[model samples]
Target: MSRTDFATIDWRGRPVRIECQWIDPERGAGTPLIVFLHEGLGSVAMWKDFPARVCEAAGARGLVFSRPAYGRSTPRAEDEIWDVDFMHRQAHEVLPALFTALKLGDEKPWLFGHSDGGSISLLYAARFPDKVEGLVVLAPHIFVEDKTVANIEIARTAYRTTDLPQKLGRYHDSADSAFWGWNRIWLHPPFRDWNIEAELGTIRCPVLAVQGIDDEYGTLAQIRDIAPRVAGICELLEIPECGHSPHRDQPDRVIVATASFITNNRRQTP
Candidate 1:
């Protein structure tokens, strides 16, 4: 594995910086590139080394980047309340722009998105199936759940008055940007009307959706709702004793399952 470097990526006329890292395998592995999209509060640093491990396991190149207001990326202003379609913007605008900036269309990368990032990945697959080789999503939210909203309130309180702001600030350049953008929409009554179930039906690639049985934010319906509509090409993996963050809670299973999914389709990358 070679060392990773930081690169400033141009996105939507703004300087939405990103960290792009890749390793050309010594063994000449046939796997397609794997692109990792981060969680709502996640950045390139928050992903830790999971992407590297997955790339190593599946013998693939990896691309990881922070979204607009997280990690080392540029921070949003103090008053940007994210709309319900915020994730859609991330999917349709930011990700594609980043890929275009990097000239990655020719590589046909596979997507690995978690939490909010997973939802973005699903939207991307639906929007650009030809460019996506496959998808591996963890704890993706296709619709809002009662528990999900409940947790958001709890998070709101903690972030507003508690040490959560401080804790999150360490990871995000603008913790307020990350926290408030995700918070207001979640607690908004209108946002409850969100349901990507229709958008997901447009996906035409093989998808591996994983969630923890003990997930605190979403339910099985999150993935199951999309599973039936996706041409029966979706695989649902529910892990026991795991919570919302499957990559952190069950890295071994995540690595194994992701490796299997990526390799299973490696030969079809024509």
Candidate 2:
């Protein structure tokens, strides 16, 4: 599929830009819509073509976009360090505002989120239960872990010493600003106290959670904590030999799992 251009949306009483990248299949006109939300350092370009593949397999429409302050969207302020509730803002405010602005809220959309995006998906589903069809999360984080902090520290080192930032620049307009803002907030002392397990109970949609068994940043505990909290249904799938980014490490497995999850949920959901 050819790449789409960037678009802008005014938010927070300011001109906060965002990119909407989607794959519209010809097979079905009213196919289910699944919105793709990227990880902490991810952009629409970094998602590569996984969104297209998943949508093709499931016969669904995909709405993939870069959030504000990431990718080709607006850059973050130099002094900005995200709060632990950053996911909350994305879920409750940014997402709703964007969907409404783009007139995408008319159709209920499923959420496919990874890492920080996964947590944001959870928050969105919990806060707006009626607007969600289902959720497919890849390597989501609901609580902080020591291993997560350790890996984040390593990423900081890599960004400074290696070509990580330069490589990210190929995908994002202001890769340095996005990378540093996310890194600093995650590494901050106050963020260490962050946890949102309490808020997940409000999610009344079917959830299909996937995580790699070998994930360096998180363990099964993150999904385990929210599995029982959800009033809807929650199914956890652990992919073997997979790491932090399951979609990157095991794309085929993720595609199959997500496709099946959406298909099965849509048919039987109440």
Candidate 3:
């Protein structure tokens, strides 16, 4: 069984809690560590057993954590509003603080991130080039698209008219906080211009960018555009008949591909 813990720290000058878990705790420290980052509306619970299964397959240590306002972690303040730089702040500030609090300074971790989480991982790897061993991103958005906005608008309607909130509540401490915080920001007019393509140039580690062929939230260009900027560092995985969440939709394939990618790269890490 995995061990669950909480890290209480000050972020943005206020106390916040991050819920984290260690998968395959029996694995030795010498094994590479894979940190799992959830999507915009995802929490620790949202990942289910995928992290553990991946770690087992890869023979790696796994760290799965919920960001401040998701899962069993802290709730967003009533007046708090997420800005365009929310993902950047998560990459630059909150994550580093969590690392420090958890005593994870000894080794560089391989990041597996999905959607917004993938974008944050990209930003983090770009900002601290040598700190990550490699990364696997699923449905990451490098630039906003008309289709992205259109789908998100539909999601907003689903939240209002359907049981989306009730469904999400099972995974979040405050479903409203988790939903609105992510939804409102993405739907904001200014966010349409949000792009991180230029930042991809600085990433020094290997990258495996995956997306479902029929992803509702983004297009193939999300990962396709990454290759030109990052050059030799980027690889693409387009899963057939898959949707936004690859791990959920294509677990066996994701597990095998991610494990193979890490194993192949780790042997070359020197």
TM-score of each: 0.92, 0.95, 0.97
| Residues 20-45 of candidate 1: C-alpha lDDT, one tens digit per residue | 65655443435568888888778887
Q: How far is candidate 2 from the true structure (C-alpha RMSD, Å)?
A: 1.9
lDDT of each: 0.83, 0.86, 0.92
Task: Return the top candidate by TM-score.
Answer: 3
Candidate with better lDDT, 1 vs 3: 3
For candidate 2, lDDT tens digit of each residue in 1-270?
A: 534656666665578888878687354446888889999999888899899999988888888889888888888877666787787888988999888877764578889999999999999998999998999998899988999999999999999899997898998899887788789889988899898898888899999999999999998998777789999989999989999899999999999989888888884323
lDDT of 3 by residue, 171-235 (tens): 99899999999999999999989999999999988899999999998889999999889734678
* TM-score for predicted model 2 compared with the true structure: 0.95
Error of 2 at 82 (Å): 2.0
Task: Say which prediction, candidate 1 or candidate 2, comes out ahead on TM-score.
Answer: 2
Model 3: CA > 4 A from native: 267-270
Which candidate comes out best when scored by lDDT? 3
Each prediction's RMSD over C-alphas, in Å, is 2.1, 1.9, 1.3
- Give residue 134's error in model 1 in angstroms: 0.3
